[model samples]
Target: MDAEVGGTSAEEDYKPESWYKVKKGGKAVPMQREERQPEVSGAATQERPNHFKRAAGKKLAEKSVGKQHVRIPDGATRIILRPQGGLAPLTRLGAARLLYYVCKETGIFYGDARRDILSPNEALQTLLIATEDKKRAEKYQQIASITTEEGSKTEIKAHMTIPESRGKGVIHNVHLSVSDAEL
Candidate 1:
C-alpha cells in the first residue's frame, strides 16, 4: 500500500510545465508570461445610467387648474389642406369633412392642430377630401340643371385640367348635349 501511494504521488508531481531553453548555454525559462489587460478609466469606462435610474427622483409638476381650452385665431376663415402623393378625389373630400367638424368642435386653427390634433395626418386628409367633393359636386349640379329642362335641347361646354395620374395634359374642350326625350 505504501509503494502504490508513493507511485501515485510521483505521477502527480511529474505533470508537464511549458518551458523554453535559453540558446546561450543556460537554463529553462517559462514559455508563457502572466499578462493582464489595462483597465479603462474616466468617461470611456463609465457606463451610461439606465433611463429609470436617471429619472428616479424626478417628479412631474401637477396641474393646479383644469386644462386650458383652445381658442381659434382671429381672421381665420378656411382651413388649407395640402395632399401629397396620388390620393383619390373621394378620399380628399372625406378628409375635408372630418377636418371641418374637428375644427368646429375643437375651435383650433390649422397650424395649432399640429400640436393639439389627435391625428394630424387624418385631419389634413379630411380637408383635402372635402375640397375635392365640393368642386366635383358643383360641376355636376350645373350639368344636371341643363339636362332637366323639358322640351328643350341644351349644350354644355367646359374646359378643365385633368389630374396627372389620369393621363397627359388638360382636357381642352368638353361638350355635352341633352334633349327632353333623353331626360
Candidate 2:
C-alpha cells in the first residue's frame, strides 16, 4: 500500500527520515542544543545620578548660595501680662471683663474685629489681637503696663512666634551600592 499524506503519495516527498530513525538522547528525554553565553564586550549596567552629581546640576549642598523661599509671618500678635505679683487665674467672665477694660484703654488693639481680643491660654495674663490695621497695630509695641478693673498695675509683654523651616518637599538622595563601590 502507498503511504500517502494529504492525498499525495509519500514517494513524491523524498524526505526518508522517520521518528524511530532519528538519534535518541537516552531515556526518551527531550534535549536542548548547547548554547554559548554572549561575550561580555561592554558594561552590563548603566551609570545613574549620584548624590553629589546629577544629570542636570549639583544638589543643594549646605555651601550652595541661592535665594530661598519667602516665608509668611504669623498672622496674629500675642500679648503677655505679668502682674506685679504673678496674675491670679481668672474665671472666663472675669477675664472677659478684664479684656474689656484693656480694650477700653488700647481701643486700637481691640476693635470691631470679632476676635480682636482673645484670652488663649493665660486667661488673665494673655491678650490676643486679630485687628486688620497692622501698621497701627504697632501701637501695641509701645504698651508697657495694664491697669485692671481692680486698679492693680501689671507689667505687659508681647511677642509673635514663627514656624521653623519645615523643609517642605525636601529630598536627599543617599548613595546606593551594587557591590563595594558607591553608586
Candidate 3:
C-alpha cells in the first residue's frame, strides 16, 4: 500500500515538543528559562514632600516680615492692634512681648501665663514694664490666689471617690462619704 493512501504521513502524525515534561513520579515540571522584569528609570520615580518640608513652609510663611494688620468686623467689641510700620518677623520672644503688651493695655489676665508668656528674659521683662507699682502688683497677686483657690475647691467637689479592694482575695467594707455620694 502507498504511504499517503494506506497510512498517515510523517508530517500528519508529527507532534511539537511541549514546554514542560512529566517526570518519573508523574509531576509535570516546567523547563527553566531566563526571565526578567522591566527596569524602572530614575526620571520616572515620583517623590512626595514629607512632614518636615510642609512644617518648614508654614514657619517660613509665618515669619515673613511685612506690615502686620488685623481686620476686625464691624460691631465687634474686641480691639485689634495693628503695627504702624513694617514689623519684624515674629520670634518666640517677640510673640511673648506682644502678648504682654496686649494684656497690659486691655487689663485682661490670661491664665497659664507661664506657657503663654515665654520665660521673660531680663531685657524683655524690663522692656515690658519700665515702671512697676508695688500696690497694684500685690493686688493682682491676691486676686489670682483667690481665683485659683476657688477653682481648686470646685474641681475637688466635682469627682466621686470609690474605695477599691486592696487585693483580689480580700473583701473589705467600703464606707462612702456623704460628699462622695452627693457627687
Candidate with maximal TM-score: 2
Could you tell me the TM-score of candidate 2? 0.36
Number of clashes in every candidate structure?
9, 0, 0
- Candidate with best lDDT: 2
lDDT of 2: 0.48
Q: Per-residue lDDT for 1-183 in model 2, tens only?
A: 567788887765454233332255544333444478565544432233252266345445432433332232455544344444444532334656666655665665444433554444443444544333565356554556666666666666655432244333533565454442332
Per-residue lDDT of model 1, residues 68-166, tens digit only: 323433322223233233223324335344444444333435444433222223333322111233333233223311111132322322223233344
Candidate 1: regions farther than 4 A off:
1-37, 42-44, 47-117, 121-183
Assess each prediction's global lDDT (C-alpha) against the native.
0.35, 0.48, 0.34
Q: After superposition, how far is residue 67 of candidate 3 from its true place, in Å?
A: 16
- Name the lDDT value of residue 129 in candidate 2: 46
lDDT of 3 at 44: 45
| Superior candidate under TM-score, 1 versus 2 | 2
Order by lDDT, highest first: 2, 1, 3
